[model samples]
Target: MTDTSSAGWGLRGTAGVSFAATLEFDAVEVKLGGRVVLDHFSLTLKPGEIVCLLGESGSGKSTALRVAAGIQPVHGGAVRINGTAVSAPGLNTPPDRRGIGLMFQDFALFPHLTVLQNVLFGLRRLGREAALGQARAALRRVGLGDREEDYPHMLSGGQQQRLALARSVAPRPGVLLLDEPFSSLDARLRETVREETLAVLRETHVTSLIVTHDPEEAMVLGDRVALLRHGRIAQIGTAAEIYRQPIDLSAARFFSPLSEIESVVTNGHAPTPLGLVATPGLADGTAVTIAIRPAGGARMAILGPGTPGRIVGKRDAIGIDICEVSVEGLDLPLGLRQPSDAGLSVGQDVFVTLNREHVLVFARD
Candidate 1:
């Protein structure tokens, strides 16, 4: 039910084609070399919604994308596009007919073909004149119209990426699958291209599933972020939702470094070096692990106002000092990240304080 009239890339999608699509992986499981790569992986992307799939290497992020594009077959479960079962046990759909566009980490542009010809490669279904018009329009949409006749080798890295995107969208597919599309760009160029890419995606309204490992990238590019673990979805939510309310310690640690404390819950609370963290549903005497983020989670306090500690080590990272404080009762030094302007030094005597929201208490494994 996407409105193709204002589709983002400026090319009307294929005639009678859906402008955007609903994609689902219904408990899909993928195996390779007799090893499970996607274990009951399930996710759903709504029409025109952009979602980021995030995880560490070997966590099945790219595998999920390949499954969506029909490049990788699932050993169990099913994949659906706009409610049609495109992939399932005993059924498989060819990638070409699925109306899904794929952009790989390398951009995958044809070195010999001119930018325009590269785009036209996917539009062969249209008449030559119509295909040319669509390719040129797609090039223009991605700011590469003037480079139509230029070969892929002639363009810069960013331009080549744009050309690949133009090629992917020229056919006006209903969904776009991008695998670490910006990971290869230099930091500055990556930022610029990310913004431009997001703009086009918003304008075209193609349902997009982007796979990346960087947490910030997930937050910046996705309406919601899905984190994969061991070939399954560990947690999925808005960046703020996942960051503020992680489902477990592993989910919390995925977003940032953490200082862990082990204790037992008593009176519905888990006591830590900082304070008692609420364990609302846990029984008394239950073992628990409390975690605190180093940055903006804990801080040096007045010498007499908080738990007494000595700054045992310190290092500067991007203007923030990661101070390691040794408390008398803890086995591990607590990490406190604060602005260097605070003038904390190693061996400095100070008390430590923490915010309740910055503390997370979970059942010990």
Candidate 2:
């Protein structure tokens, strides 16, 4: 999983070295305006490990990060770094002394300061010469060594963001907090910047908590994803674990685009229009929701002497055709696998069949 590049200034030249650091959050909770923002939210990240708080807006993802960084006061609970209690009720430490770096979504570079100045801002307590030297080195690590004199506006969006990261980490913080770092970038540039940012972070061995709503982004960046639900963690695992074995239908859909099909579970199997799918350990007579991913290769069983379904309609998606198929009077929308100039034509009966093993079944609540 390591990438080697000739543009090397990081720990690339070293052998058997990792940026990994240990980070922990213990029963952290926060309240805003008399409402609980985070309740018993907890996660751990090993040194050089990137953990993402994955959830939608107002789900306490950012609040958790801010509290961990000591930027936001906690109403209850505690946060720790490397097992050292950093935040606890009635004991507040200033952000600068917490050894936690925060990179905001807006880059937050001082408008008047040049790129180098912004990076050197945190290092002021150190003598001027030493601070400048460290800032130069940090800028070099982010591939902006020569552009130190350029103002924040002079640099590209990605470069500006990298500057912000450099500023946050200039003091060599033990933990890094990123709040939707790539949300402001255009889609095409976001992934590239993310990759670069991750590389830089890995090089420095900074334990990072990335807050993002995009599941795919979390999958690509995090060693583990904490799916936050209503101020609590709904699921926590690697991308494959969360995607393949979600605890419920909500978690399943949150991690991936899945179509839910209602089925009656019987004898460790669920009966669907596609066929009887075996779901071992599922209680019999329980109504369950079967989650099917788009790339599961489940064929329509309505045609070709297979299962029965009526073609309801089809829509034109930029890269794919989405077909709506009704089975047993239930409308299930699925992305059709075919290429045509006109896309999927409306009203075409088709057979659909999926590997029962890939179907994720969760109790309907």
Output the lDDT of residue 362, model 1: 84
After superposing candidate 2 on the true structure, give the runs of residues whose Cα lies further than 4 Å from its correct spot: 1-21, 300-322, 326-329, 336-349
RMSD value for candidate 1? 4.5
Report the C-alpha lDDT of model 2 over 209-254, residue by residue, as the tens digit.
Answer: 9999999999999888889999999999998888788888878778
TM-score of model 2 (CA atoms) = 0.87
User: Best candidate per TM-score, number?
Assistant: 1
Which pairs of residues collide in candidate 1? Answer: 7-204, 8-203, 8-204
Q: What is the C-alpha lDDT profile of model 1 across 156-214, one tens digit per residue?
A: 88888888888887787899999999998998688768877876787678899999999
| Model 2 lDDT on a 0 to 1 scale | 0.76
Question: Total clashes, candidate 1?
Answer: 3
Computed on alpha carbons, the lDDT of every model, listed in order, comes to: 0.86, 0.76
